[model samples]
Target: MLSSLALLSVVLPSALAATTYDMVKEYSGSTFFNDWNFYGQFDNLTNGDAIFVTSSVASSSKLAYVDSTTNRAIIKVDNTSTVAFNDKRNTVRISSKDEFDIGSVWIADMYHVPFGCSVWPAFWSQAPNWPSGGEIDTFEHWNLELHNQMTLHTEPGCTQASPVQTATVVNSTDCSFQDNSNAGCGVMDSTDSSYGAKFAAAQGGVFVTEMAESGISVWFFPRSSVPASLSSNASSFSTADLGTPTANWPTAGCAIDTYFKAQNLIFDITLCGDAAGAASVFQQTCSGVCYTDYVVGNGSVYDNAYFDVASVRVYSVTGMNTIVRVSSALGFRAGCWVWGAAALSGAVVLFAL
Candidate 1:
């Protein structure tokens, strides 16, 4: 009885703490498109250069489909149809059927992204209620520009000053919408190789976004530089184990939990409206031609306008187990994993019986 009572003291607390991450959800494979809700019609990005942009998106069209060759979801902007002076170009905008809350990790594996003149492609997530719910842009680029940008847009009073990563450029540390730059609290890759043609030349890569108590982090892993743990093809993994991220937005001066909440994942393509055509944008890519004219008239230029995605895996924070070390008289402490308190108590009672 004495020995058993001593064991109970140590084992009870440890059992309640030993936990592990479980794969709560997975959206993988070509058929994965079936699980997503496609937004046909026009793009919802009504601000910026996109205000002038319209959509010819259709539900059963090639603008969004599953490719047979690579078994990846192929989302594209239409360059196949005839375009007039004022016609909306064909494009695709889709989103996940599900929504994710805070403290989740999102992994998107892609093969190609729609790129080039007057084009804008983005993979992002946003909550239902504007800036109050927070926004995360995992992939965004425009025109002939050769860099990838990851931005976070949130309500007022949120500013991040996390340690900068190697070669990462911080465009703004404040995510509030009041900033004139609209750069948001974001970061950009130093080299052009991480986006557009150069990124395609290297066969695409993985973009991972992890949202936890520490704030938000975005990491880009070129196909050649992917980690072994992620390459193993598991349904879920801990973001804490991913080491240093390419972009880290720690909640040092702000409470990220207060500003951000459930968000719907979205993928969209728009042409010559906000960012590309704005008077302030780097519009030199169009040369003497008008941005809209080139985008609408030059139908053949968008032949390669598309996003090829292999899969998007989502993981919840419940995966991280709380490890409480316990040393019994027998000194059994090495890798002895148990469970919650209620389960352990019941087991001890049965053992006594």
Candidate 2:
């Protein structure tokens, strides 16, 4: 005779085993540009009035470079040339050459992030096809906003049904690309130091994201509070050690495996486009028309529009096989449980008999 408790344990997967990560890629210092692909002259998908330059232009203009003194990587918007009205400001948008699937974790150690009127910057991941492939925004903000907004965008049929246990407030529960004018499901970190001027004042920090079949989670650590085990040279890390994340998307609400797919890491800074260019969103934190007042200026207003990155590390999962699908919420309710492999493949059949 099999006990119900024993049966349940055998049928479930262990969250701890699944979350352990081993470092696989590190983008840092002089070699940062080697692994990235410039988008090159493409129209801003967000409708922002910025010109994304090619790798040669970026290198020639010093728009993207490794600081010799600090050994840090810098990616910035052009602040030297005055642009005529209706013309686009030159900027940079780059994506990782390698893509990562589920059971992956990314940690970005940033010393500074872009901020200014009409400036929209983001550190995110996306599938090549988009909408259908899915998008995960690890860190994003526009204008002079004070907090980071993390979001997920996917094709129709995903929703945030389970409440997240984190330090963020949910802005929307729907993750569909068609709803909310394609806003997707978003949550805002509940801290002033998570973005904008304040974050820069504190010398920036780390943003960590975990993507798994069960769900996705994001955490922000101020430079002063970052764990010692996390750094540019870190070889491995355990997500279980990171306390409650800033935002969590559990599987109970959305099928993460179905909506999200292999994703390439990306970073970009654009001016007065898309979300930042919208009159309604722009008026809240900035003044003047988004295009006229900011896009045509001598570029002095964008002195702060840059990223000073210590490193970006990608870790792949280890020790756990993701052959079986499990509900993340079940682990939450059951208090950190794991099922044996034999049970996962054979126990269900025995229980049914």
Candidate 3:
């Protein structure tokens, strides 16, 4: 059955509500809709899921769009037709116009989140540099998982043991190359409603990520629970006022300022990648054949694969280059976009994954 979510009430601390943070960047409505640069293509060979099409092709295929309903950005996976096992599924992947560094807070207002079988959608942040710049997976939803995942990827010398908040479930503490690849130090939000169907049922809401001198933290507010100050009308939004975070990554064992730098916000939907496709359940559904076979055969399974984002706004303390006015359709490309080139062309790549 299709699920829809409602708003959750959030009680703001009296002391925090009085304060305010400057609203630096706001990506809402149609004015800034076209400012996004369309990615022609990107290949995640290490995961070995499927090939992605360019933005133009994605728009043509109804996988991506921006209009009245999608003025904020609506991206989805191939659900309109029966796909061939060999044929790649259509999807949408996009990045913000500008690069954001530490001490920035991002709030994503979503109406629908990606869910369903063989689906892996992520809204993460990363720098142009690979492991050096670091990556933070704010919300990575996999059909196989029951909770929301928050991970940080960086070079060697980062651990989640000390300084890490115990509110969430810590998987691996190491943010370095655990197995020649940055598996990342990650934690899971045990709240069932924090992701997927539960989140969708709540009508989706806000995802707040704040990177400060202390560490990185994430908060998810369902539509019913969004902070009053952050709703349609309020002076401004601030991290101090939001109370405690759902996921917090302190710097006792890690130097967040060192690893995490200027990064672009990203959103993408991938099918049968290294994580989802490699699972036994993923293979079991496809008649003992390949994961792609199941995904191709059960095309209707992806009918709910879509992202109806209402808003993506960024706030800053200093208010540095806050808003990103839309430039060309393909404004500026991030170096990280070419993450795996040689590996795709059949050659040795510096960063394995």
C-alpha lDDT of all candidate models, in order: 0.61, 0.74, 0.63
Better of 2 and 3 by lDDT: 2
Model 2: lDDT of residue 23? 79
Tens-digit per-residue lDDT, 1-353, candidate 2: 01111211111212332367887778988898887878787443666788878889999998999999999999999999999977898899888877787888889999899998899899998765666568888998888888887888888888766544455355556777666545566667767888989999999999999888778888899988887778435687777667667777777777888888878788989787656776766787788899899889698878999999989988888754322221222111000101111222231110000
lDDT of 3 by residue, 1-353 (tens): 00111111122312212224566676767654454555556445325344566767876886777657556667887776776656666677777777776767788889778876677788887775666778888888566455677878888887664433324345456777543245466566657777777888888888888777567878877789888877763436656657777766667677788877877788877776655554443443233333555456546777777888877877775545434343344543343221221211232112223
The clash numbers for all candidates, in the given order, read 8, 1, 10
lDDT of 2 at 217: 85
Best by lDDT: 2
Q: Indicate whether candidate 2 or candidate 3 has the larger TM-score.
A: 2
lDDT of 3: 0.63
lDDT (Cα, tens digit) per residue for candidate 1, span 218-258: 88888888777677767555554455667766677557788
Clashes of 1: 8
Error of 2 at 148 (Å): 0.3
Best by TM-score: 2
lDDT comparison, 1 vs 3, better candidate: 3
Query: Model 2: residues >4 Å from true position, as ranges?
Result: 1-18, 319-353
Better of 1 and 3 by TM-score: 3
Indicate whether candidate 1 or candidate 2 has the larger lDDT.
2
